[model samples]
Target: MEYRVLLAESDRSMLERLCQVVDDTPNFTLAAKFQNVSDALGQGAVFNPNLILLDIEQPGGMGLVDAFKKVYPAASILCMGDKWQAESASGSIKAGAKGYIIKPFSGVELQESVDAFSRLGSDGSAEILVFFSPKGKSGKTTLIANLAMSLARKSGEPVGIIDADLQFGDMAVFFNLAAQTTIVEAVRDIRFLSPASLSSYYMPVAPNVSVLCGTRTPNMIDKVAIDKLENLIAMSRGLFRYILIDVPAGFNPTSIAAAEASNTTFLVSMINGAYEIDHMKRALHIFRDWEDMENRAKVIFTRVEPCDAQARLELSQKLGYPVTEIIPNDYAIVSDAADKGKMATDIRPDSPLSRQVDRLADNIIGRKHRIRWAGV
Candidate 1:
């Protein structure tokens, strides 16, 4: 199919560059080019454009999305800007734009943005969440499962779970999914895959939720490079609305990389271990230097007896770091859900454990998370 692109930009240099680039791209035709929004709106229809690259930074530029739609209803309008602007990207999407891209972006970037953002219903970015545990048996996997379920149910969008434990991830076992391909295959083939093709590697375990299972054997962990895993997560952002990564327990490269990539990192510990608080304290001190560590990284303690505000405050005071949330634990419900291949939220939605997870899901969506690291 031919992509007859109409370009509108206030900057003359950018307009020329976009016109040249679009004309040079495969299957792309520079239907028309203009230095301002009004000209595009006035004459864009004559081009019969199926794709439009519009600058959203100029005065009255963003407001033309609806007009462009009215003029060329068949065109896929991609908003462009001088730099990253969340409000602009969101507003363009809300105003019927297919996606947003930066100025001087290549044809590959342009196509990728449109294809990826189209996955979301009037949204652009995904919530990359990292669930970290100081050690194994922190109930992090269970937390991911229930929270993912809640998120999927509430949003009715695709949620991705990447079991990055490398050695002993139980995501497939918990979901009762027999993986035909695991992270190993994904990493091996990642260099040759696109968002749509890579999606085939993930197994659909629940409605609107998919799991990229870990290696079939512990030794296969070596095949799953940390860089590749991060790249996999990056590529997945285009595909999933909410991506929950279950990193290996402890502060290894995989865990650190995942945490750094995520907008929110849930640093989880449980009451079963007496040393958990100390471990959490150590992790907090290490993470303090990271940008917005105080905000993006949440301190959570599981299996607490009280699981109250007082407990959170006391623990926060004890650790010299704010305790963000707590989970009330009853092994029975979690185990029962796992045994039945169902979600804890599905089994006991009103249970304390499930309720806390539901609240967490809400927080993930409702909370304002800073998307970029500062001083970049």
Candidate 2:
């Protein structure tokens, strides 16, 4: 598990500091260190490094990115700069750098960067599904979490959940994971991140369900730019089989952007006394105007009563759209599971609610239905 590191920094002070840090870091061995760009490019291959921490801001440093990328195509190239230089970082990324990290970072940060890069693969294709609700209290988070676990289990692949509910996301509480790294940081540094590096930001709650949390404060939402959020979603697609985004409720920029990026957007509404159907109708109209959404988008009704064929038909007729799913109200089981930071299915595998979720998972994976609901 040891990572062979090759570092190149022209600055004497910084080079010395980084060399000392790398030498002392565990599971990492400094294969080589150079103060000159030529020396690094000339002898980099001999080291056979797993990671190359290059100073892209140094003289001829930017050009070395392409040279190393060509020579050592398998190595993880990470550009290090004196500060957060967006333009230089963007250039490094364009030239094939996996990511960029600010200089003077601690040993832990360096290890994290290396570890993140190690987790990536060549293929980045994944199914991106965004779970969006017209308003709050729609059970969107609950549904997404359970569905994520189900999909992971069914597919036998890792599933990633981006808690895009920036203002007040409950994913951390739902999964009972500590907010280690939030989406705010991921979006801020996404331009310089890769699939391997992106994995570092997520907290793995289930065996195959990884979660990237939301902002700790509500005001931090404005800091997550639209382009950054888009990039995060795109990068995640490469690393996982299914990317589930729990977007903020309502038709804000965050929700809209996530919905657009997803291959399948589930517009969920709970059968509460509120005018959720009306809200969903309006939301559908908005999405229908966008490209590819008319067919990719579907409405899901949660907390439905009876959850039978007749109820489904009546609700679909009332909403004027085909209801893709009707999740029955299982308040006691759901509440107990949520309190324990577990999915309801885990608590009672044969419960009605779990059966409905299982069917939903089966449908998503193109499986034939096994549910025997007769003569409604």
Instruction: Return the clash pairs for model 1, or none.
Output: none
Residue-by-residue lDDT tens digits, candidate 1, 66-127:
88888888788888877644456557777888766777877776655656665675555578
Q: Pick the candidate with the highest TM-score.
A: 1
The root-mean-square deviation over C-alpha atoms between each candidate and the true structure, in angstroms, is 7.9, 6.6
lDDT of 1: 0.82
Give model 2's clash tally: 2
TM-score of 2: 0.68
The superposed Cα distance between candidate 1 and the true structure at residue 81, in angstroms, equals 18
lDDT of 2 by residue, 1-376 (tens): 7879898898888999998898898888999998887888788788899888998776676888888888778787888887644456556666777666777777787876554444433322467889988888888898989888898888667789999998998888898888868999998887566455678899998888899998888999898999888878876754577888998888999898888787789999999878987999988888877676645787788999888878888888988878878899999999999888799988887888888887777777552123432211
Looking at candidate 2, what is the lDDT of residue 183? 95
Choose the strongest candidate by lDDT. Answer: 1
Tell me the whole-model lDDT of each prediction, alpha carbons only: 0.82, 0.80
lDDT of 1 at 106: 74
Native-structure RMSD, model 2: 6.6
